[model samples]
Target chain A: MPKIVNHEERREQLAEAVWRIIRREGLEGVSVRSVAEEAGMSLGSLRHYFDSQSALLAFSMQLVAERIKKRIQSLPQDGDPRENIEALIGQIVPLDEDRLAESQIWIAFSTFALTEPELRPLSREIHDSLRDVFRNIFETLAQSQLLKPGLDTELEAKRFHALVDGLLVHGVIASEVVLAEEIAGIVARHLDSLLVP
Target chain B: MPKIVNHEERREQLAEAVWRIIRREGLEGVSVRSVAEEAGMSLGSLRHYFDSQSALLAFSMQLVAERIKKRIQSLPQDGDPRENIEALIGQIVPLDEDRLAESQIWIAFSTFALTEPELRPLSREIHDSLRDVFRNIFETLAQSQLLKPGLDTELEAKRFHALVDGLLVHGVIASEVVLAEEIAGIVARHLDSLLVP
Candidate 1:
């Protein structure tokens, strides 16, 4: 009998290899050949799953977005408004190695998205989707009477979203000087500022 | 008579060419040969200044840091704390076409800095140098009673720096969603938060 290969599992396996390539050698090292070699698979075998470089990259990036969304979605549903907000934002920042890798890969793909039109939709979609999470969190807080009266939920949502993106990038690039803990504290403070006085 | 090439000027020209290539074709498109061709010079001539591909990239990255520093230093010295802080922060953000191109190239180099050890020092230097500017500005502001009392100058500076860096990255990557005016307004609001009551 011929060996059975799960195509979905195989594609994910290929993506993990790509992730390792990004984690070890950076995004510039993630060519088809390199990824296949890293995956311990034949180039022909890898190509069967992802026919083109862009397809492979898109799949890998989508996996990243999904994983992050899943983590946030998995958070316990019993926390207070502040606790839940912090949990949601915490999942995105580089508070741990997993999130750090995600942040690094996200930054790498973001630059690639600028020049590769094929990647823009994924980038924009991930961005819009992430902001939606923030919006939902803000709306929840607003309804709970945690948000200051008359605060513009839309603008506050956008600010909090931008703040997370900014902190992640700066934390990655200037991690030596701007420690992630310091950023998390500032974020906590920023979140606190939204509460009713 | 063969026109004597001013090696320094030629280097600036080449770096400028690299910048142009980066802006026009993306960082992935840059090469010693491409840069040479862009500058209308031979590869031999280009190699005289940058002995290796890494060397050329290091110099190009350094050129970006220097250009930004020069622009910040060029700000008039009337030295109103608020004006100076705003101008310095503005220099780093993508406010206009020229600065935007510089920002695009800077973001490209920022990702390259992750994998290339050769480029890391320049990245660290630029990172620290910019961080220090904010640090010094905050220190000055703190001393002048412009900043809110009890704020840690260094920590607040890092927060402000991170805020600016984060906003710039999102602006570059998600400009359609996070408009330039919105980013500017966020920066202004954040800065206002640092002011004395």
Candidate 2:
């Protein structure tokens, strides 16, 4: 065999380049040629990694999900349900410059997915996973009797999920009006209202 | 003398063609050539109204806003404040087939506008006007002494606006799970919680 380049490391490097292009120039700028240039690699090498444009986009989208999952996983295990939930929700919001760029890219991808059939299944899977994360958190609160008695868990789960998604979208658009700190405060207040008396 | 086509009607006809193309083939399908074909007019004739693609898109976007304003103006005045608000909110949601089609076009345009700087100002203006409509309704309720005494009108306004936007985004993606009726129920409950004691 010729000199063996680490494929996984190379893929990570390409995905990071994809993120950078998306951050700097929006999704429309993320072609294979552009990404290859951004990664300081030959087009052939990038093609060897991703095969096609859809494959590259799909992989990039999955990378975003993985980063979010990793961030949530890295949170300390303090064992406080509310703290955990808050931390998890906080990760999705645009609290800093990096996350804000990611949010913009995420929103752009979700929109493009609506018309592009190849991306729809992945989008659906990511959405289901997010809803499940919220559902599990709500279930934990219910088990701990943290949620108000007689609370409709399913409906509350949907509402809470909507609240986070809503906050992220508005924050992406009108950051001046809906800052990350304010979003956290709103989340805290909403959660406090739902807690057991 | 040449026959004079009604300017207002011709504009509406052109916008309708744009809407059809957006719904049937997505925003990327919307080009001067495609829209002219869809409208059964030559590109030269279409040029008489819109000098450029950006101008065409801006006018199409504004037409959607105008339609919404007209719908709101037509709602009967016999309903109570709660009913009026619900009805107003209902108009924005994809309750029926026609509104659902319009929503698909509306969302696609919003995504396109995000990347197109020329269209950004018009998008911002439309969004501000939409928010003002919501703000005025909330202000009405507060002024009429129908809302809770200590309610933060601005916070509630933004929250409600976010809730509606959240529902629309999710509705486009996961409408089967997050039904429109459920969103209406959530809105109703959120409003009921703030009703004056």
Candidate 3:
């Protein structure tokens, strides 16, 4: 009998290989051949999954987004709105090793997408979706009567989005300076500032 | 008689070429030879200044930081603390074409620095300096008797730093969504939140 290969699983394995290369050598070091070599697979087999470097990079970037989304989706939503929102953000920032690797991959892809037109759509989609996530968080606070009266939810949403992204960058790049606890504190302080005192 | 070349001016020209290449093709396209070609100089001549690719990148990144520092230093200090702080931040975020280019170059270099150990010190230095700039802004507000009473200036400084850096990233990556005007507005709102109301 012929061996069975799970195509989806194989693609994910290749994407993980791309992540390892990105984490070790930066996005600039990522190429189809390098990724194939990293994955311990032949070029032909890797090409069967990702026909080109751009396709591989896009998939790798997409996987990072999906993992974060899945984690956020699986979080318990029965807690206080504040804690729920905090829990949601905790998954976004690089608070641990896995998240740190994800954050690094995201930043690398984001920088790459700036000049690679082919990758911009996915990058923009991720950016838009994250923006919506922030907006919904504010809406949830307002619905729960936790937000300050007369606050502009839209503007607050944008500010909060920027704050979290900035923390993400600082957490990944300047982890030594901005510790994990400090990132959480900053997020809590930001959330508190938007609520009724 | 032999023609004279201004070494400092020539180095700046080469750095500008690196910026143009980075803006156009991303940092992945930046090599000493590529920069030499972009600058319309021979590799032999380019090597007279930068001994290696790492040296070239480090200098280019340093130039970006220095340019921003110079702009901030030249801003008039005699205005209202709020406006002064806003103007100072204006020099940091990508509010215009020149700044937008600088931001893109900075982001590219920063992402490149992640896997380049030789480039980490300059990246860390720039990060530390920017954090200090935010700290000084809060101190200015406190000295001017404009800060909100009982606010933790340290935490507020970190929050403000994150917010502005976030705005910078958004202004560069999602210029279409965030817009220049929105970045300015976010900074103003953040500053307002820290001041006496």
Candidate 4:
């Protein structure tokens, strides 16, 4: 009998190779040949998954987004709004090696997006989607009557988004100086500032 | 009499060319020949100013930090403390064309720093120095009795730095969505949050 090849699994394996290349050699090191070597697969085999470097990078970037989305979707939905919110947002911040790598690659892709017209929209989508998520969080708090009286939801949402991005960047770049617990603590405190006081 | 060449001016011109290339083409487009052509100079002339592509890139990156440092240094030291802080931080954010270019290059250089071992220290230095600057800002606030009573200067300093960086990244990446004024507003509110109410 012929061996069974799972296409989705192979694609993920190729994407992981891309991440490893990014982690080890930066985005510039992710040519087809390099990724193929990193994946321990032949170039021809890798080509079956991604036709070009750009396609590979785009897929890899998408995979990072999907992974975060999946994690967020899988979070416990026990309906403690505050805890749910915190747990959901925490997945995006670089709390551990896996997340730090994701954050680093996100930054790399974002930087690359600034110059690459084709990738610009993808970067914008991620930024805007994250902002929307924060907006919904604010809306949820407001609906539950937990937000501060007379607080503007729009501005507060933007502030929350900015705070999240800031904390994530600090956590990733200066992890030695700013521990993940500090980031979480800040988030908790900032969230407190939003509630009725 | 021989034409007096201003070496500093020429180097600045070349760095501008490097910036244009980065803005127009991408980091990968930067080469000695390309920069020489962009700067309207001979390859040998450009080589005299920058011995190699890496040297040119390093200097260009250094020039960006120097530019921001110069801007911060030139801000009036006579304004109110809060206003002074706002204005000083504003110079680093991308409020206009020149600053936008600086911010964009800063991002590119930072991402490039991820895998470039030599550039890594420069990136770390900027991160640490920014943290120190924020620390000083918090110290200034504390000395003036402007900060919330018993606030942790170290943590607040880190938070302040993270806020500034987050605003900058947001301003650059999603300028259409997050305006400079919103960033300023957020900063003002955050500063207010840290003050005794």
Give DockQ per model, in order. Answer: 0.64, 0.55, 0.89, 0.65
Q: Which stretch of 10 consecutive residues in model 3 chain B shows the poorest summed lDDT?
A: B188-197
Q: Count the backbone clashes (under 3 Å) in each candidate.
A: 1, 0, 0, 0
lDDT of 1 by residue, A93-185 (tens): 988778888988998898888888888999898888888887898889878888877777887777777778878987777666666678789
Number of the predicted model whose lDDT against the real structure is largest = 3
> Model 3 over residues A1-197: C-alpha lDDT tens digits?
99998999989999989998998888888899999899999999888888888899999989999999999999999987788999999999999989999988888898999999999999899999999999999888889899988888999999999999999999977978789999999998887788887
For model 4, residues A95-144, the per-residue Cα lDDT tens digits are 88999999988888888878787788888999998888988888889999
Better of 1 and 4 by TM-score: 1
Docking class for candidate 2: medium
What's the lDDT for residue A33 in model 1? 92
Best by TM-score: 3
The parts of candidate 4 lying over 4 Å away from their true place are: none
Residue B184 accuracy (lDDT) in model 2: 86
Q: How do all the candidates rank in terms of DockQ, highest first?
A: 3, 4, 1, 2
What stretches of model 3 exceed 4 Å from their correct place? none
- Candidates in order: C-alpha RMSD to true structure: 1.8, 2.1, 0.9, 2.0
Error of 3 at A55 (Å): 0.5
- Better-scoring candidate (TM-score), 1 or 3: 3
lDDT of 4 by residue, B89-190 (tens): 888887787887887787788788778877777778888888888999988999989887867798778767777788888988887777778888888888
